[model samples]
Target: MNTKMFCYQCEQTVGCTGCTGNAGVCGKKADTARLQDELTGALIGLARAVDGAETISKRTSQVIMEGLFTTVTNVSFDDAAIETMIQKVRAEKERLVPDCSKCQSSCGKTDEYDMQQLWDANEDVRSLKSLILFGIRGMAAYAYHANVLNYEDAEVNRFFCEALFKIGYEESVETLLPVVLKVGEINLKCMALLDKANTETYGTPEPTAVTLTVEKGPFIVVTGHDLKDLQLLLEQTEGKGINIYTHGEMLPAHAYPFLKKFSHLKGNFGTAWQNQQKEFDHLPAPILYTTNCLMPPKSSYADRVFTTEVVAFPGAVHIDEKKDFTPVIEKALELGGYKEDQILTGINGGTKVTTGFGHAAILSHAGTVVEAVKAGAIRHFFLVAGCDGAKPGRNYYTEFVKQTPSDSIILTLACGKFRFNDLDLGEIGGLPRLMDMGQCNDAYGAIQVAVALADAFGCSVNELPLSFVLSWYEQKAVCILLTLLHLGIKNIRLGPSLPAFLSPNILNFLVKNYGIAPITTPEEDIKTLLNHNK
Candidate 1:
């Protein structure tokens, strides 16, 4: 079939290749995809303008981060919104180099890049640049969240423009490869920035059990990964006879001290982001999307959707920067939730799930954990984390976690944990066998825990008895994977499948150097991972 668009940035691309028809696998229309490409191209133009400028201001960095974030999969499907973003990006470039557009000579150095060039480039070059582009796109989400909390990192901000500039400028493998890997190195810092922002703003997360029940009352289900939006919604709905529940990646908000203190901040609603369509069909409460993991809303509940920040969809009431959630609050009161308290079970049939094993929480139990490992009570550690998707093979994660030895512990984050998070994995030496380390960005906490464990064991992280069996769906996973590779951690088993954008040569390089491979059967993978040494 002749293709109207080309996208393979997510795990569930059409037929494990590219989505090339009227709409992408995530339901992004071709026109919307084109606009996203244009937005991305315009972001590169803004970065180009920053090149000859005196200094990078906070506003310039914010524009770049917001632009790149808007283009991430399932973030913004509204073409009007994307066009507006493109205009904003162009305006920023104009502010940066005012005379470039007016100059008679017209060097075109500050002109917006044609993204089709990167898409149609040589296969290897395309793959490398895709790594840098998509990796930074993921990093932008983290940086944006931090910026909202009034926490900004200059190096992380500077790298955003640098990566975008390289995506449009550098081509050779030798020249691009270092920049590609640098994305991971910088993302580590970005994730850390977000980590500090979240913990300091909300207080360290503590282990808390969140119910899967939607109580009988007016309520709002906040999805995506924005805590600030959720906080605002909670404050506005306080004592207004409304309850708030989290959905998808926002499930971890229940663990934070500040959020948990809200009496109305009740439980979690649905499972992962992929299940939103069925789970939300005629859902009585409105869902507020603060960031990505947004599938196009089905007509049944489309009217009940509210979006804020970079997340946008046509017809959904968007809560702007003012953060007034009155519309969402009124809608919830109108819907009136369920007639009775409805108990919802996770994919594994458990009625409640626990989260908030952040690095601080986990480290507080460091003595117990170290003793458990030294005493042979803990055999291994498996981090079965990453984004969840609608793909079929994702059941592998559920089974992998289920089949883990009773003596082992599972460290998970992101929505992927919804698979087996409800299952009773029991505990080892006073620590629950399964630990939810907050959201996907909480991978920072997991890294910290690993590093601390390695230090306690007098070994490197690779020598510790820990493994990363990850499931990835979107660009955020791309950046996190690159971060793992950047840390030189080896033998990472990634699935439901490898990224479609990974060319054969790049895949080979990752496999040979970092021991990355697609996941196989639960039994085989578990045995191999258990017996294998790095």
Candidate 2:
């Protein structure tokens, strides 16, 4: 147990369990991991101190959300950046508990939590707390995006402190269980907040085809999921002879009317975050990461990497809150882009992909979709969504989406769509069968579509001919999945593997109660889901 690093918070942990070595399977160093733990512990302390607020201020909530989300897997790797976050949380804690240290009797009201204690706790308890902790981390991303747009939900913000306090203070598995599910409940609110923030700020997304080709010339590749940053960059880069290409979760930006207005804002650069190391290695463009799913940069591409907001690597250029992307612009121009226009296809080898199918767009065509169902043109709907990763078995998503019957429509979100997004799925009733439903936070939109369809069909969502085949790699996906479970949605297929954080008993409980199962072959799953639909 005296390991240099102890982390199993992600799907890519060493030995398919915990990483107890010098480096994590995701390329996080022990030093960075320790700092992340400290950041998390400090955030938990802030949460503990600020507990029971009559009304949680947006500023306190912002700090809590950023601190929690910053510690999510593969988010931040710089010890310095994490230390800064630790300081922010500590300052907030001090602001809340000015007199706690001067009290006559000692009260450990806001003591910083030791993450190792949670890691070392009993298996079931650890599993529940992990769900609560990780779920909020995911929820925080949505909350962060919302806050960036001046949209804040007090309830969703309050739940963060409540959940973090539970992680630091509550000991019972029974006590942690409901809070674990409440993470799902509150995340639904968080996602809804983000959905409103985005649709209101950027306008409702419509289906838009995004080119995979990176145009010849100086261009900066923006990754992660911050739309505001992308918009600001687009504004700054406009007519600068510098093309801006979206990458990772930012691919959905191409569908936003406001962003797409920038003609020089070019296409997407890479598939998912996991491929950045390989994809950016030979790239002549600088990559600006605005959020998570950032891999530790390889030496070859390290210099081309720029991080902003909560994302960081030790040596990469850090864009401050001013949103001035000049460093990334300068880096991209220095790289001089390509000798000729570079055509980049997705993993499927298709030249283009479509996105922008948020809730409003989907519901606008709701009547047609419903009529198609009645006409038997669309027999089923598969919500094949969640984060994409580098694991071998992730091809299951591609195969699953590909193997879905022609009569079935695929509703997708997040970066996982890169697997088959390039593949032309054709159309059913004048609607593209493969509909991209914005970013991971837009899982709220997917939920809305599901609910609307159920309401139109006069049946429970579980009774509808819909299936959820999700692939999770990090905390955001965890919260989205929890939101699903919170809605009492059943018969979900999660893969390429279940989380290591879920103990045998806790996993068993999920299976028995929810009918959630790990994905098998695409053929087998398709058949099972089709039969279940019958």
Candidate 3:
């Protein structure tokens, strides 16, 4: 049967095919996903119209990024929020192509393309467009993160339009391949901008160990991707007798010296982003989401879900652009956390996991790492990181990390590390076996480490003995994957599920050229990887 709705942009789609019925596995209604597609299509049209229009304004670029980011998994589950974004996109298009509206006969030039067309097109065409669309969606997340700090890169912003414009046009692999790589190239710039903004503003992250224990008294649990919101919360809740515990992506915030300096700022609360529904339920403190990966809050903690900076859930208290977190603070005091200290362990029953092994921290210890490698202490480096989700099969990550040879080093970032971050993997040459490289947006750190290692060995990054086993749940990961591909990095094993968006032809192309494969059982996949290395 022909598909009714085309919504397969995440790891958890209905039936593991695509969500074609009334709602997606993520609970995104058909209407909302369609609007998201429309918004995306309009952005593509705008990009096409403004192809070389002198210069693209920051406002235009911000709207494009925000529009794309809103469609990411678990971000805006509300259809009304998407409607508002669609309107915003239309308004932006109107501003860009005002003359098109006055044409006596309708000019298809500025009109949005129905997403179903791309979904139902020839496999090759659909695959190429999916790359363009998904690639931009990922880039938008990095761009959005960078934008929050008032740092912007012109090249990155310009490429957003360029990539989107290509999605709406007819193009081949030979012609579109460059645009695909350009997405990765621009995403690298975007990540660097965010890295600079975060390090400069929050101070370079150090090798810090964060405890899972929640201190007694009033505390606030903050999640999502925005460090700015977490910093604002830290500032406002200071000296108020309320403690702040980082949760989910915010765990990395504790690694920053500027953020960690606050006495009230406590340690991390949960493992990864997917466990929020279970973890946040009946929690004594208010949970604040500054960005995406917000699960539909359960009634038990629904009232306690506070949002800020574009993260919105109906009926949740939203901190506005002014960034006043008074509501969240009030909720924290009202909730009045545990009377005594509560010890919380990770998935592995460990009480603490260390983070802050960002590019700077790792590169500073490069000499030690290289020496360890040369001395036969570190045999392989496995980058086992990506988005974490509720999928049952995602345990592959935990098992994969568990089964890696003792001689290997594990580098992880993003929410995915929650799966095995707590396991006591022991240390190699004074460095922890599992190094947390900050948040998902901090994929930049992993890239930085890979490049530094390659430089030390005087080899190309692909020549280094490193393997990336990624598990993606959202669009931010999409951009990072593309960046790796753009750098010509090969033999990546991606799972728990392939994105529903990629057509068979595109999948074949990636497999043939990039050696990308969906993960199998941990035991089997490990054997395959070890053999490949041999």
Candidates in order: C-alpha RMSD to true structure = 1.5, 1.6, 2.1
Instruction: Report the C-alpha displacement of residue 163, candidate 2, in angstroms.
Output: 0.6
Report the C-alpha lDDT of model 1 over 201-292, residue by residue, as the tens digit.
Answer: 99989999999988898989999998988888888999999999999999999999999999999999989989999999999989999999
Instruction: Identify the superior model by lDDT, candidate 1 or candidate 3.
Output: 1
Runs off by more than 4 Å, candidate 2: 1-3, 99-105
Which residues of candidate 1, in runs, are more than 4 Å off? 1-3, 52-54, 104-108
- Model 2 TM-score (2 dp): 0.97
Whole-model Cα lDDT of every candidate shown, in order: 0.91, 0.88, 0.83
Q: Alpha carbon lDDT of residue 435, candidate 2? A: 93
Candidates' TM-scores? 0.98, 0.97, 0.95
C-alpha positional error of residue 32 in candidate 1 after TM-score superposition, expressed in Å? 0.6
Better of 1 and 2 by lDDT: 1
Q: State the lDDT of candidate 2 residue by residue for 152-266, as single tens digits.
A: 9989988888998999888888899899889888898888888888888988788898888887889888888899998888888877789988888898888888887889977
Clashes of each: 0, 0, 0
Model 2 residue 53 CA deviation (Å) reads 1.7
